[model samples]
Target: MPFQLPDALATSDDKPALSLLRRYYGDAVTSAGAAAGAAFDGWDSTGTRTADVDRFTADDLLAITFLSVRVPPRAAAVLLRDRAAELGDLLAELGPDRDLVGEDEPLTDDCWPGWRLQTALRDIPGIDTTTATKLIARKRPRLRPIWDKVVAKVTGTHKHQWEPVRVALREQHHALHERLVHLHGAAGLSAAVTPLRVFDVIAWREGKDRGW
Candidate 1:
């Protein structure tokens, strides 16, 4: 069951998402957060030790900082010490190549591991829901969709986001996914930016416009 995109997502001539992408991530080389996100993904390349599914590096925290979120020393210590193994276990359960648009519906069987990890990350002292999701998305860009307060407000997904976001991406035979890819190229964004991130920015921008 695909999500019926609201009027706010007038995918016709307006192309609000594409415009936002262009405004924020120009040519992928000179935008505000573009360099940071690209740098982070470059560092998190496949086959690297830092790219290991089970653990996070100081670089990961540093990367999110570029996007305006930070994990303080105390929370970082907690993640490194108390949560690494558990997070790794959950990551191992999920497919490395699975994209959000292709996730199984009801989402229970396939997405449960991620949900468990998300819950655990949010439980950390200094990590809120937005920070937790951003951290998870950084590691599994293809598999995890980010949801900050603004994005949640715009999408109206709030505390429950996975199913609705998945449905939106799956809508019209994966129209949103195609739009994201097109916007990435059209906006001249780096390949490092995933489709999920494109959607996140779009929703986030819309939320900001609405003063959320």
Candidate 2:
């Protein structure tokens, strides 16, 4: 089943979940966007080690671990510290390129730079498919989509591997990106929120609400 945004939510028809999410977390999303934009800008201007790590502090990683996926803080800390350098290098490679797929090109595990990052992150002691992708997406928002059980179930890509999800995203990159941008504008989300993040939020929200 190909993923489709529900028309009710698309039009902002006061769906309970969508409305609640917007009311409760809209400000947080806006703040996150601001932080992310500043972080990226700092990285571009000065090659500081902190910038290299996507300006993520230990607190940020811990918050992401617990709030985003309910992972244990201790485990998340170990993974973050151990793979700090590798994560930095991966973000540096992705840079500002949002389009990682080529037209008429076959999508493979090694086709996009994200694949290498995902593979490496997945090998960490406490990381799994969702956590690995989320970590990278936090750093390279434009280039990667955060994945989890909800996203996989909603997208109907039963396997939690990055390859299939990446292929699907690449195929619909243009239209999907456009939709996200439109949604962002309509919702009055901060300009700093990347289209990929908007897309992830919408999918995640819909999936969670509908029990996918």
Candidate 3:
């Protein structure tokens, strides 16, 4: 069965979801280019640079800053220094294609290990939920969707967002993901951009418009 979007996300005759996705993504891409320059390019295009899942790179840290989040210096040091081995071991639990949309098993069952990793990251000093998720998303763009306040409030998934979002992405045999891919291509986004990211950007932009 297809997952019907909430009224907030439903498309009307005047405002189609596809067009809105394109508009929002376009604005973001433009802003990223202007603000992040090479760092954004490095982050946005997987073809140009493969992310080091086992370690956070300079580009990874710089790129997230463009998206309105920054890893505090102390936290960055902890991630890159004190807990390097621990981070690598945790990230090793996930694979490149471990996308939530393709998943059919319960998220808790299949993704608990990674969830533990996320929790550990969040436990670091100066690293909040948003910053931690963004850092993980940098490493596993397809597997981890970046969660922020605006998107969480708009989607009404503040406390337990990932499982519900996984359900939405997996609905109707991933029809929503298919639609997102279509919109991504239609919007002329980079090949590296995942369907998960397309969904996130669209929801985030819409949330911003609503002043959430």
Best lDDT goes to which candidate?
1
- The candidate with the higher lDDT, 2 or 3, is 3
lDDT tens per residue, model 3, 1-212: 23235342455332455555556444444542222321342364334345465776666777888788888898888888898888877887665546778777666653476688888888898988888888887787787877888778667776456778888877778877777777667667776677777777767777777888
Error of 2 at 140 (Å): 0.6
What are the per-residue Cα lDDT tens digits for candidate 2 across 84-110?
Answer: 666666656655545433333544647
Total backbone collisions for each predicted model:
0, 0, 0
Per-residue C-alpha lDDT of model 1 across residues 52-114, encoded as one tens digit per residue: 656776767877876678998899988887777777777777557468888756665534878
Q: What C-alpha lDDT, on a 0 to 100 scale, does residue 136 get in candidate 2?
A: 68
lDDT of each: 0.71, 0.55, 0.69
RMSD (Å) per prediction: 3.5, 5.9, 4.1
- lDDT value for candidate 2? 0.55
Steric clash pairs (candidate 3): none
Clashing residue pairs in candidate 2 are none
TM-score of each: 0.83, 0.66, 0.82
Give the lowest summed-lDDT range of ten residues in model 3.
32-41
